[model samples]
Target: MSYPSLAPYIQKRPWLMRWMRPLSEWYFDNAGYRKLGLRADDLIPEEDEMVQLALKRLSPKEAYDRVFRMRRAFQDYPYLSPLVKEVMAEQTEREDLESMVINKRKAAGEKKAH
Candidate 1:
Protein backbone atom coordinates (compact mmCIF):
# COMPACT_ATOMS: atom_id res chain seq x y z
CA MET A 1 0.00 0.00 0.00
CA SER A 2 1.19 3.48 -0.91
CA TYR A 3 1.22 6.06 1.81
CA PRO A 4 0.21 9.63 1.03
CA SER A 5 3.03 12.14 1.27
CA LEU A 6 3.17 15.90 1.00
CA ALA A 7 6.70 15.93 -0.41
CA PRO A 8 5.69 16.23 -4.04
CA TYR A 9 3.06 18.84 -3.20
CA ILE A 10 5.53 20.90 -1.20
CA GLN A 11 8.28 20.57 -3.80
CA LYS A 12 6.02 21.78 -6.58
CA ARG A 13 5.40 24.97 -4.65
CA PRO A 14 8.65 26.90 -4.19
CA TRP A 15 7.16 29.03 -1.42
CA LEU A 16 6.00 25.99 0.55
CA MET A 17 9.34 24.31 0.07
CA ARG A 18 11.09 27.41 1.29
CA TRP A 19 8.87 27.59 4.35
CA MET A 20 9.07 23.90 5.19
CA ARG A 21 12.77 23.47 4.47
CA PRO A 22 14.09 24.88 7.71
CA LEU A 23 11.36 23.29 9.81
CA SER A 24 11.93 19.92 8.19
CA GLU A 25 15.67 20.17 8.71
CA TRP A 26 15.16 21.16 12.33
CA TYR A 27 12.81 18.21 12.87
CA PHE A 28 15.23 15.80 11.23
CA ASP A 29 18.16 17.18 13.15
CA ASN A 30 16.41 16.73 16.48
CA ALA A 31 14.67 13.48 15.56
CA GLY A 32 17.41 11.52 17.44
CA TYR A 33 18.10 9.26 14.46
CA ARG A 34 20.77 11.73 13.45
CA LYS A 35 22.27 11.45 16.91
CA LEU A 36 22.43 7.70 16.41
CA GLY A 37 23.90 8.25 12.92
CA LEU A 38 20.92 6.54 11.36
CA ARG A 39 19.03 7.71 8.29
CA ALA A 40 15.24 8.06 8.08
CA ASP A 41 15.06 4.95 5.93
CA ASP A 42 17.08 2.98 8.44
CA LEU A 43 14.24 3.28 10.92
CA ILE A 44 11.99 1.29 8.60
CA PRO A 45 11.63 -2.25 9.92
CA GLU A 46 12.86 -5.22 7.88
CA GLU A 47 9.94 -7.44 8.92
CA ASP A 48 7.83 -6.28 6.02
CA GLU A 49 7.99 -8.63 3.01
CA MET A 50 8.24 -5.66 0.66
CA VAL A 51 11.26 -4.36 2.53
CA GLN A 52 12.81 -7.81 2.54
CA LEU A 53 12.35 -8.09 -1.22
CA ALA A 54 13.81 -4.62 -1.68
CA LEU A 55 16.85 -5.60 0.31
CA LYS A 56 17.30 -8.70 -1.80
CA ARG A 57 17.17 -6.60 -4.99
CA LEU A 58 19.91 -4.21 -3.87
CA SER A 59 23.29 -4.38 -5.54
CA PRO A 60 26.06 -6.12 -3.59
CA LYS A 61 27.80 -2.81 -2.91
CA GLU A 62 24.58 -1.14 -1.84
CA ALA A 63 23.80 -4.04 0.45
CA TYR A 64 27.27 -3.78 1.99
CA ASP A 65 26.91 -0.01 2.41
CA ARG A 66 23.58 -0.47 4.19
CA VAL A 67 25.14 -2.89 6.62
CA PHE A 68 28.13 -0.61 7.11
CA ARG A 69 25.91 2.39 7.81
CA MET A 70 23.87 0.44 10.32
CA ARG A 71 26.96 -0.85 12.08
CA ARG A 72 28.70 2.55 12.05
CA ALA A 73 25.57 4.59 12.85
CA PHE A 74 26.03 6.76 9.75
CA GLN A 75 23.85 9.74 8.86
CA ASP A 76 20.46 9.15 7.23
CA TYR A 77 19.36 9.17 3.57
CA PRO A 78 16.45 7.51 1.71
CA TYR A 79 18.13 4.75 -0.32
CA LEU A 80 15.69 1.88 -0.09
CA SER A 81 12.36 3.65 -0.44
CA PRO A 82 12.40 3.85 -4.24
CA LEU A 83 13.09 0.15 -4.54
CA VAL A 84 10.31 -0.65 -2.09
CA LYS A 85 7.93 1.51 -4.08
CA GLU A 86 8.93 -0.26 -7.28
CA VAL A 87 8.30 -3.63 -5.68
CA MET A 88 4.90 -2.55 -4.42
CA ALA A 89 3.99 -1.19 -7.85
CA GLU A 90 5.00 -4.42 -9.52
CA GLN A 91 2.89 -6.42 -7.10
CA THR A 92 -0.11 -4.21 -7.70
CA GLU A 93 0.32 -4.55 -11.45
CA ARG A 94 0.53 -8.32 -11.23
CA GLU A 95 -2.61 -8.45 -9.12
CA ASP A 96 -4.46 -6.26 -11.59
CA LEU A 97 -3.35 -8.40 -14.53
CA GLU A 98 -4.38 -11.55 -12.76
CA SER A 99 -7.81 -10.15 -11.99
CA MET A 100 -8.22 -9.04 -15.61
CA VAL A 101 -7.40 -12.50 -16.82
CA ILE A 102 -9.84 -14.08 -14.41
CA ASN A 103 -12.61 -11.68 -15.46
CA LYS A 104 -11.95 -12.39 -19.13
CA ARG A 105 -12.18 -16.11 -18.52
CA LYS A 106 -15.45 -15.72 -16.65
CA ALA A 107 -16.89 -13.62 -19.45
CA ALA A 108 -15.87 -16.20 -22.04
CA GLY A 109 -17.40 -18.98 -19.97
CA GLU A 110 -20.67 -17.07 -19.64
CA LYS A 111 -20.79 -16.42 -23.40
CA LYS A 112 -20.33 -20.09 -24.12
CA ALA A 113 -23.01 -21.07 -21.62
CA HIS A 114 -25.48 -18.66 -23.30
Candidate 2:
Protein backbone atom coordinates (compact mmCIF):
# COMPACT_ATOMS: atom_id res chain seq x y z
CA MET A 1 0.00 0.00 0.00
CA SER A 2 3.07 2.22 -0.16
CA TYR A 3 2.68 5.19 -2.44
CA PRO A 4 4.94 8.00 -3.52
CA SER A 5 4.71 11.02 -1.23
CA LEU A 6 5.19 14.54 -2.55
CA ALA A 7 4.98 15.93 0.98
CA PRO A 8 8.70 16.75 1.35
CA TYR A 9 8.89 18.38 -2.06
CA ILE A 10 5.67 20.27 -1.47
CA GLN A 11 6.78 21.42 1.97
CA LYS A 12 9.92 22.99 0.53
CA ARG A 13 7.75 25.27 -1.58
CA PRO A 14 5.20 27.30 0.39
CA TRP A 15 3.27 28.23 -2.72
CA LEU A 16 2.92 24.58 -3.73
CA MET A 17 1.86 23.55 -0.20
CA ARG A 18 -0.74 26.30 -0.08
CA TRP A 19 -2.13 25.18 -3.41
CA MET A 20 -2.14 21.49 -2.50
CA ARG A 21 -3.38 21.77 1.08
CA PRO A 22 -7.03 22.05 0.23
CA LEU A 23 -6.89 19.25 -2.30
CA SER A 24 -5.05 17.03 0.18
CA GLU A 25 -7.63 17.78 2.86
CA TRP A 26 -10.44 17.08 0.43
CA TYR A 27 -8.88 13.79 -0.59
CA PHE A 28 -8.42 12.69 3.01
CA ASP A 29 -11.96 13.65 3.95
CA ASN A 30 -13.36 11.79 0.98
CA ALA A 31 -11.25 8.77 1.87
CA GLY A 32 -13.82 8.25 4.68
CA TYR A 33 -11.68 6.42 7.28
CA ARG A 34 -12.34 9.32 9.62
CA LYS A 35 -16.07 8.76 9.32
CA LEU A 36 -15.45 5.24 10.60
CA GLY A 37 -13.36 6.63 13.46
CA LEU A 38 -10.08 5.27 12.12
CA ARG A 39 -6.89 7.26 11.68
CA ALA A 40 -4.62 6.61 8.73
CA ASP A 41 -2.23 4.50 10.81
CA ASP A 42 -5.09 2.18 11.80
CA LEU A 43 -5.32 0.96 8.26
CA ILE A 44 -1.82 -0.52 8.29
CA PRO A 45 -1.78 -4.30 8.05
CA GLU A 46 -0.90 -6.26 11.21
CA GLU A 47 0.25 -9.51 9.66
CA ASP A 48 3.91 -8.59 9.44
CA GLU A 49 6.35 -9.36 12.25
CA MET A 50 7.52 -5.75 12.30
CA VAL A 51 3.98 -4.48 12.67
CA GLN A 52 3.39 -6.99 15.47
CA LEU A 53 6.54 -5.79 17.20
CA ALA A 54 5.41 -2.19 16.79
CA LEU A 55 2.07 -3.06 18.34
CA LYS A 56 3.83 -4.69 21.27
CA ARG A 57 5.93 -1.55 21.71
CA LEU A 58 2.87 0.73 21.95
CA SER A 59 2.20 2.29 25.33
CA PRO A 60 -0.66 0.86 27.38
CA LYS A 61 -2.92 3.85 26.66
CA GLU A 62 -2.13 3.88 22.96
CA ALA A 63 -2.68 0.13 22.69
CA TYR A 64 -6.02 0.52 24.45
CA ASP A 65 -6.99 3.39 22.18
CA ARG A 66 -6.04 1.40 19.10
CA VAL A 67 -8.20 -1.50 20.21
CA PHE A 68 -11.06 0.84 21.03
CA ARG A 69 -10.90 2.45 17.63
CA MET A 70 -10.86 -0.90 15.85
CA ARG A 71 -13.79 -2.18 17.88
CA ARG A 72 -15.70 1.03 17.27
CA ALA A 73 -14.99 0.81 13.59
CA PHE A 74 -16.38 -2.75 13.65
CA GLN A 75 -12.92 -4.04 12.74
CA ASP A 76 -10.18 -6.24 14.15
CA TYR A 77 -6.86 -5.30 15.85
CA PRO A 78 -4.02 -4.10 13.60
CA TYR A 79 4.29 3.54 12.45
CA LEU A 80 3.54 0.37 11.71
CA SER A 81 5.08 1.37 8.38
CA PRO A 82 8.23 2.96 9.74
CA LEU A 83 8.87 0.07 12.09
CA VAL A 84 8.29 -2.38 9.31
CA LYS A 85 10.71 -0.50 7.09
CA GLU A 86 13.31 -0.46 9.84
CA VAL A 87 12.97 -4.19 10.40
CA MET A 88 13.26 -4.82 6.68
CA ALA A 89 16.35 -2.66 6.42
CA GLU A 90 17.96 -4.54 9.27
CA GLN A 91 17.16 -7.85 7.67
CA THR A 92 18.68 -6.66 4.38
CA GLU A 93 21.86 -5.53 6.07
CA ARG A 94 22.19 -8.82 7.90
CA GLU A 95 21.77 -10.78 4.69
CA ASP A 96 24.23 -8.58 2.86
CA LEU A 97 26.83 -9.04 5.58
CA GLU A 98 26.32 -12.80 5.59
CA SER A 99 26.77 -12.92 1.82
CA MET A 100 29.88 -10.83 2.01
CA VAL A 101 31.37 -13.13 4.63
CA ILE A 102 30.51 -16.19 2.56
CA ASN A 103 32.08 -14.62 -0.54
CA LYS A 104 35.23 -13.73 1.36
CA ARG A 105 35.56 -17.24 2.68
CA LYS A 106 35.06 -18.65 -0.80
CA ALA A 107 37.68 -16.31 -2.25
CA ALA A 108 40.13 -17.25 0.51
CA GLY A 109 39.53 -20.94 -0.19
CA GLU A 110 40.18 -20.37 -3.93
CA LYS A 111 43.44 -18.60 -3.15
CA LYS A 112 44.56 -21.47 -0.97
CA ALA A 113 43.63 -24.00 -3.68
CA HIS A 114 45.54 -21.99 -6.33
Candidate 3:
Protein backbone atom coordinates (compact mmCIF):
# COMPACT_ATOMS: atom_id res chain seq x y z
CA MET A 1 0.00 0.00 0.00
CA SER A 2 1.24 3.48 -0.83
CA TYR A 3 1.42 6.06 1.91
CA PRO A 4 -0.02 9.57 1.55
CA SER A 5 2.59 12.33 1.43
CA LEU A 6 3.02 16.07 1.73
CA ALA A 7 5.94 15.99 -0.72
CA PRO A 8 4.05 17.78 -3.50
CA TYR A 9 3.00 20.57 -1.19
CA ILE A 10 6.43 20.94 0.33
CA GLN A 11 8.11 20.86 -3.07
CA LYS A 12 5.89 23.67 -4.42
CA ARG A 13 7.08 26.09 -1.77
CA PRO A 14 10.75 26.96 -2.13
CA TRP A 15 11.08 27.81 1.58
CA LEU A 16 9.52 24.54 2.65
CA MET A 17 11.59 22.60 0.15
CA ARG A 18 14.76 24.20 1.44
CA TRP A 19 13.77 23.54 5.04
CA MET A 20 12.87 19.89 4.45
CA ARG A 21 15.69 18.95 2.04
CA PRO A 22 18.33 18.44 4.72
CA LEU A 23 15.92 16.68 7.08
CA SER A 24 14.77 14.34 4.31
CA GLU A 25 18.37 13.62 3.28
CA TRP A 26 19.32 12.98 6.90
CA TYR A 27 16.42 10.58 7.37
CA PHE A 28 17.24 8.67 4.19
CA ASP A 29 20.93 8.58 5.02
CA ASN A 30 20.21 7.17 8.49
CA ALA A 31 17.54 4.75 7.29
CA GLY A 32 20.32 2.14 6.80
CA TYR A 33 19.18 0.74 3.46
CA ARG A 34 22.18 2.39 1.81
CA LYS A 35 24.51 0.51 4.11
CA LEU A 36 23.01 -2.68 2.72
CA GLY A 37 23.49 -1.32 -0.86
CA LEU A 38 19.76 -0.98 -1.39
CA ARG A 39 18.23 2.17 -2.81
CA ALA A 40 15.17 3.75 -1.22
CA ASP A 41 12.89 2.26 -3.84
CA ASP A 42 14.28 -1.23 -3.17
CA LEU A 43 12.45 -1.22 0.15
CA ILE A 44 9.08 -1.15 -1.61
CA PRO A 45 7.47 -4.56 -1.28
CA GLU A 46 7.21 -6.70 -4.40
CA GLU A 47 3.80 -7.94 -3.23
CA ASP A 48 2.27 -4.77 -4.70
CA GLU A 49 0.73 -5.09 -8.15
CA MET A 50 2.03 -1.70 -9.24
CA VAL A 51 5.50 -2.63 -8.11
CA GLN A 52 5.34 -5.93 -9.99
CA LEU A 53 4.21 -4.15 -13.15
CA ALA A 54 6.92 -1.54 -12.71
CA LEU A 55 9.55 -4.23 -12.36
CA LYS A 56 8.41 -5.76 -15.62
CA ARG A 57 8.70 -2.37 -17.33
CA LEU A 58 12.26 -1.90 -16.11
CA SER A 59 14.93 -1.83 -18.83
CA PRO A 60 17.16 -4.88 -18.91
CA LYS A 61 20.12 -2.85 -17.68
CA GLU A 62 18.13 -1.34 -14.80
CA ALA A 63 16.83 -4.76 -13.82
CA TYR A 64 20.32 -6.16 -13.89
CA ASP A 65 21.64 -3.19 -11.96
CA ARG A 66 19.07 -3.65 -9.23
CA VAL A 67 19.99 -7.28 -8.78
CA PHE A 68 23.68 -6.40 -8.81
CA ARG A 69 23.23 -3.71 -6.16
CA MET A 70 21.29 -6.06 -3.90
CA ARG A 71 23.98 -8.72 -4.31
CA ARG A 72 26.81 -6.28 -3.63
CA ALA A 73 25.05 -3.96 -1.16
CA PHE A 74 25.80 -1.03 -3.52
CA GLN A 75 23.64 2.08 -3.43
CA ASP A 76 22.04 4.07 -6.26
CA TYR A 77 19.44 6.73 -6.96
CA PRO A 78 15.70 5.89 -6.94
CA TYR A 79 14.48 4.35 -10.16
CA LEU A 80 11.53 2.04 -9.51
CA SER A 81 9.28 4.23 -7.40
CA PRO A 82 8.46 6.63 -10.25
CA LEU A 83 7.54 3.75 -12.52
CA VAL A 84 5.41 2.21 -9.79
CA LYS A 85 3.60 5.49 -9.31
CA GLU A 86 3.00 5.69 -13.06
CA VAL A 87 1.61 2.17 -13.11
CA MET A 88 -0.61 2.84 -10.11
CA ALA A 89 -1.97 6.01 -11.74
CA GLU A 90 -2.69 4.15 -14.97
CA GLN A 91 -4.49 1.38 -13.08
CA THR A 92 -6.51 3.88 -11.09
CA GLU A 93 -7.52 5.67 -14.29
CA ARG A 94 -8.53 2.43 -15.95
CA GLU A 95 -10.57 1.44 -12.90
CA ASP A 96 -12.26 4.81 -12.82
CA LEU A 97 -13.17 4.55 -16.50
CA GLU A 98 -14.53 1.05 -16.03
CA SER A 99 -16.64 2.10 -13.03
CA MET A 100 -17.91 5.37 -14.48
CA VAL A 101 -21.69 5.71 -14.91
CA ILE A 102 -23.06 8.20 -17.37
CA ASN A 103 -26.49 9.70 -16.66
CA LYS A 104 -28.51 11.20 -19.48
CA ARG A 105 -31.01 13.74 -18.21
CA LYS A 106 -33.90 14.93 -20.37
CA ALA A 107 -34.26 18.67 -20.71
CA ALA A 108 -37.39 20.34 -19.17
CA GLY A 109 -38.39 21.67 -22.64
CA GLU A 110 -38.14 18.18 -24.19
CA LYS A 111 -40.30 16.69 -21.42
CA LYS A 112 -42.88 19.39 -21.87
CA ALA A 113 -42.98 18.74 -25.61
CA HIS A 114 -43.43 15.02 -25.03
Query: Candidate 2: minimum summed lDDT over ten consecutive residues — where?
Result: 101-110
The regions of model 3 sitting more than 4 angstroms off are 73-114
User: How do the predictions measure up, each by TM-score?
Assistant: 0.51, 0.52, 0.56
Q: How would the candidate models be sorted by TM-score, starting from the highest?
A: 3, 2, 1
lDDT, each prediction: 0.82, 0.83, 0.86
lDDT, candidate 3, at 16: 94
Better candidate number, 1 or 3, judged by TM-score: 3
Off by over 4 Å in 1: 72-114
RMSD of each: 15.2, 13.5, 15.4
Winning candidate number (TM-score): 3
Clashes of each: 2, 0, 1
* Candidate 1: tens digits of C-alpha lDDT, residues 1-114: 556889999999999999999999999998766776677777777988899999899999988877887987644555678999999999999989888843334554465644
Would you give me the overall lDDT of model 1? 0.82
Model 1 residue 6 lDDT?
95
